[model samples]
Target: MALIGRISLDVVARPQEPTAKKRCLDEPQPDTLKRAKFSDEDYDANKRLRKFQESWKVTYPWVTHEAYDDDQKPGLMFCATCRAYPDLADKSSALYVGCSNMRVDPLKKHEFSSAHIKATNKKTKDTMTMKERSELATNSPIVKATKRCMQITMNILVVMFNTVYSLAKKCKPLSDFETHMELHVKNKKDIGGDYMDIGTNYHNEKRAKEFLMSIGEQLRVTKTRLIEKVRFLTVLADGSTDSSMTEQYTVLVRYVSEGYPVTTLASIEDIENANAFGVKNGIENGLNKIGITDSSKIVSVNFDGAAVMMGCKSGVSALMKEKNPRIVLIHCVAHKLELGVLDAVRSIDYLLKFEDIVKSIYKFYARSTKRRRDLQAFADILESELLHYGDVKTVRWVASKARALRAIQQNLFATLGHLEHAASANKTEESGKAKKLLHEMKSARFVKYLHLMMDYLEIITATSKKFQQNKLLIMEVPDIIKSTTDELTLMIEEPGHQTSTFYDHYDPETGDFTDHGDHVMKLSGQRLTTYEEDNDKTTLLKQTVKYLEVRFMDFNEKPLKCFDAFNLNKWPTNDTELVKHGRDDIKELTQHYIDILTDTEHSSMLREWTIMKNLLRKKKTGINCHDLYCELLQTQPADIQNILTLVNIMVSISPSTAECERQFSAMKLIKSCRR
Candidate 1:
């Protein structure tokens, strides 16, 4: 006989031969010895087993639980204690069965069975002790809540840290952070819960300073990681006098990190001496502080062409060159370009006089309180906002000139009105000065010169800005210089540009160019007519073109030929000098990077060069070295590694020390007069 527990009627039984012997009641069940198959009846019975414990656990506390709905069958509920032993299933009463109706009180009857007591004693003897269970329950909730609280605190700290670092980078005062925290605290109270204490912990300057230091450490660690991978580096430094009368040198490091050129500020330190040795020692100290010790790893050094910095025997570039003969020395391209522009304009007499006239106009108003007030009165009368007249600064070559011209252009009518009124009044010493300015402003030559120079300055200013970009590449600058010079040439040679759109104050409603005729006609009783150009305009254009040719000739020199070799628009032909420079001169500098390629890659390099010549001829403009390298890498992968490596190495030589100039700007904000 077999116990048929939760057996479905639909189950098919295997045929068995009839036996003569009668089975005894004490025989073990065949199904229980082997695993049972799943049936619909078992699934129905499993549901009943779960509901039984929920309603009857309190009525029979000694009856322990078991899981049902297992893989072999729908499953069964059994007494926990009785199921612990193996032989009880063969008894007249087995204590385990599938749960059905809770109303039958099956668990109550099973609790009193004799087999239950033995199994319960065996299982409890080996289970967890009462003290151990109690300790686990007590500590689990506390550990979870502590972790949640710490996570919230760390999140708040991170937010405060980012806030302080952002404000510090912009040179904002730390008191602003306190005010921000106060606002947050008030908002938190209004929201009705004390969920976090972020405002309380970081609402002061001391904490803000600590956060700023932590951010600095994070940047240092990141730079260190990048430096560890660099095969070579270039160190750039320049000296400037800050507002505090202290000599400061800003140090920058240029290196290849992950196949791209990156220039990052290493440090800014104050020095007593402002010579080559002072800057050299200061840079060495900064490099040491940043953990860069190997001088041999420095492949190049760049600085402005100042005598103190670019001197052949004693300059920083020359001194570094002495230590490592393989190292390249480059004067800052932006500084050289600015000097070229200055040299170009200085050769012409009228252009020099034009610059003086612009400076005089700025000073006439800025140096006199009465003239400034009179100019403001005229501006107000015309319903225009106050104008900022800028002074000429020696260091800010392009921007200062451009700004002064733009100011005069934007407020031409009001300026002319103020000068004419002052000339008519003639009540003070400034009136006499204003009378002279009135005559100059009304001159036909001055008007034409203003238009000509303003247009020229606009081009120079735009190119100068590109030069000052923080990560300018050396190969990219020659194109900008060529384009500027070409544009300047076009302005000189191209016809009818004089009658083209000139910078003038425009009427918002009418969309026509407005002039000082109405204001001057009323004050001087004479109507101002349009100015006609004289021969000075032709002379000005000629001198500008001549100066550009003389100054930009250096970029075409043999030593700098490598910088121009890859230009798509100006590809060198098979001239002996060009081929020699492209092969021998460039190879001398790029040999270190070329050594990194495998034999197969070196073969690929020659193939890529031949392909580039054809491709570049088709696409003359806007194809940079990086673009050419990418095309080569796609078409021929096996040959591109050496060229790619060389391009990355060459680009790491920064074209300007503008980053050093920026540090001085920051120093002014940090050590302002109030500080």
Candidate 2:
């Protein structure tokens, strides 16, 4: 019975299967195979699997589920922005394709990932209009943060630069840069950011030196540009040994800038050899460094009266003149004055003796603190203020000697009292020297010579001060020399006030002393006879006058004398006198500067010279050459351009090397022994 039932069931199932199998084979086989592979139990189990949640979209806006047609299937998660811009997406990231492992961790990780953020930003940028993109970029938090960082960095750099500049300008050592930066950081805590805390390596001595060099290079470039624009310039040079015993030559350029003569230091070179050729090379190198390559642009050169600098044939000035014959070579007038005075002093025996005594007195007090205290004590006792003794410098002889003489004169009674006390106190070597100095001080001849020199130097010292003036013009030099010579000549006829006062102290006839004033000592030596005194005075005064004339004889000659025409103070007031007044001078000046002027310019200068005289005569105002030239420069008339240029050259010519001397003084301060 079971076999018969099985066969009957197989027969019934086979007929139903045939129709179903036929249908499956006729239709697509993929869906039928899928249905055959999974039963209802398996489908229910797979539908229970975890899927991308819609709630994740709240936390991660870039998250989205994979598209599905049926609700029974599990969905994959993905970053929609990353999928749209696949290049900006991470290739290994599961979210970049479709994340089947639909956990919140992967979605959260992808949302904050660099790739996802970049894709999101790119999508936002692509969708915006131009104006909208600009606004978004401007208002973005990241951009604002970046700008703030840049601003802080710039502020830090500015502070560092300013600190370096301040130290350099004050001539402080570069090693002090660390200390200065620390001070800034302490005062302004936010100045250097992390740089300040990490040590001074960022702003150390090496960095300071680099900053200083950069600053110097920039300033040099700027000055070179300014010099290249000017038509003419004057050069002043001087050489000296620094603390390291290195010979340094300082070169300065003088040019007319905005109607004022500006003397600027161009360069300070370390010269191995300080001879004529070496010094000339140094000067040319300095000028070249400042963009002054054309030797013809140099209108004048002023140097001290050293043979190597001012020699006629083989000197620096001569060499420069050989290159450009139009250049005017000037011996520093201040140096000339000093030399002239020294020559006169060397001719007189008593004056030389007087100089030795003065120097000895200075050294005696300067060397001993005890002697200085005693001198000060005696000075206080006499109720007179005394100046400290100054060394008699051989370079600036007259001025330094005058200061020393003034000190002695003010402390005359105090010095005598100190000497008398020391002489009586003991038999020490110092006391013996004091006794000898006291004997010399008490002599009538010594007192007379002291006051005589004091009076004579007072005049020369005043003249020396004028000669050292930086703005002293060549046209005014002759007048200064003439006035100084006349004042000295007047001193010869009428004795100086101090000398005449000394004569009042003692009896003229007898060789005996009278009741001396409290300021001076009673003298016991023989007084000078009137003839001897006159002869001595005549010798010093006449020799000084003669030497001054000889030393400054060039100022009275050709081109320099012709510059007098530019002296408005000496201009003739009358029209008849003015018409022909500067005609010869103009011709000579034009001929002198023929190389510097064109033929048209020469003719224009001649015509303008007369016109200028006439125009200035109409105004009749007492204006100086500099002031007149500056006013004319404001208008810059076409006809007077050549004359104006001539005046510019003249004013730019320095009368002395005082500017170079000042630079040396500054160099000494900067490169001191301790440094």
Candidate 3:
């Protein structure tokens, strides 16, 4: 709209001046047709100052100075506080203020609406409010009279406008229907509904996000009704990169509990640029929403125990320190347990050996889809009637080596049968390889000792009805140590006790003894009479005594307290295996311990089978307790699963999401739709 002041010049008749000659007006230049350009500093500034002063006079009459020079532009700019050097020559642009939108805090932007009452309470039968006076155009006489009055007023205003500046504004507010129109306009478009046609739609997409945030707030408030409200919560944040994708993570309390399952999630905040102080921003924003923040209420900020997360700069822990150094960074226990188990399982001999065998065996059996199916079928058949998932069926875990040991034993017979069939079908070298595996596998003690390696609970199924049930042993510190020590001494002493008996002489070439070397010989000479006699007696006696005293001690005592019972019952009364012919087979090798577990040790372990049965209480209850142990009554160890089971026992009994899994799940769903 352009403004022009009217100028009137009246002619004073001077001797009846002759009429002026009419000259043709040349057509305007094409360049002159161009609309007015605003390239001048002084003119634009003067106009803006005048307009600003006029607005001030109407809206802020308290200001003293109203007059303004357009060339000087008496405008206080939104960006006048910007850090820049101001120059007088730069009046074409800003001296200090620059082109930028003013900051508007959401709560400060608009006035609330007791001022904007609807004419007829739309949903209720209340009287009309002033703002709604224009909308109450019902068929009732009062409403009709009001509508006619409004129309007459509007017509009177149009006539008045002809006397003033000739209707410079293009847009006009509707005379009636103000309240209903306000509601309709809001329903059709975005927010800021007061000025109907100002087009606030695309400019305020952040409002959509703000609306979603309100929903999240409602969810958190509902979920946290059961928890102790933290006055201020310190957000724990991290950035996770998955397959080169990055997301910002913020953790806040959503659930309420005094002790156990305490919190749930409100939302996931993906970091856009990861502002240098996202942690600070997150903490501040979160605390503000919770509506009770003091710097003191932020007592803790726990983070993943990574170096970066606790480092001195932008770490979640460190960031909180930047604000309040008193905020603590606690370590997550599950992570610590993983580190522990990783350490303990290293350098374990059996596991290393087992891993080697399993990697090979699993690879071979898992070669094709058919073979994998066959394995599952074999596991199922071994499980009879129908397989329950719990039936010692193989599943891979971190210590997969241990499971592999059981696997070799459980399916040995079935494996051998399959290989034999394979040999019959194809007698090639590959088949020969299978035959070799069968042969080598058949030699291992796993098949013979399979029952010993299984969980005691499984053994209860195969147990004889005649035998007594085992008892679980709850071990106290003293008892555990006592059992361990006694078992070791017993194993060590037994061998010597057996060798205490006298044997005379044995033939050199054949083991058969001459009559002089038969049984029941005495300590014939305290001192040897001759060198030959001295040599023989000293050689034999010293060797036998040394073997019992030193070597046996080491072998007997090395196993853990859990295996103590085996040492007690499996000990040797005599170093001999009885043959079918009822003769003793004597061998120097019995003391050599070719098998990792000695026979006497195995026997002793079997004798105290009740103790072995107690070790696996963590897996099943009352299943392995034999009748004898039941008669005796012993407490058993807790059935634990993985290392995390302890953490599960201690911290997770409360049952809230320990992480933002649920909130993240919803957020992920949204992103999936976007893709």
**Candidate number of the best TM-score:** 2
Give the candidate number with the greatest lDDT.
2
Q: Which stretches of model 2 miss by more than 4 angstroms?
A: 1-171, 174-179, 189-204, 391-396, 505-520, 529-533, 618-624, 634-639
Please list the residue runs of candidate 3 whose C-alpha ends up more than 4 Å from where it truly belongs after superposition: 1-229, 232-244, 247-250, 254-261, 272-295, 310-315, 349-368, 376-675
On residues 48-138, what C-alpha lDDT tens digit does candidate 2 reach at each position?
5676678888888877788567765567777788889988889789987687786788877777889888998899889999999889887
Cα error of candidate 1 at position 291, Å: 2.9
The 10-residue segment of model 3 with minimum total lDDT is: 578-587
Candidate 2's TM-score reads: 0.76
RMSD of each: 16.8, 13.5, 32.2
Off by over 4 Å in 1: 1-146, 193-195, 366-387, 391-396, 424-427, 470-472, 494-554, 571-638
How many clashing pairs does model 2 include? Answer: 0
Q: Give the TM-score of candidate 1.
A: 0.68
TM-score for each candidate, following the candidate numbering: 0.68, 0.76, 0.32
TM-score-best of 2 and 3 = 2
Q: How high is the CA lDDT of each candidate model? A: 0.66, 0.81, 0.35
Order the candidates by lDDT, highest first.
2, 1, 3
Error of 3 at 30 (Å): 99
Residue-level error in angstroms, candidate 2, position 366: 0.8
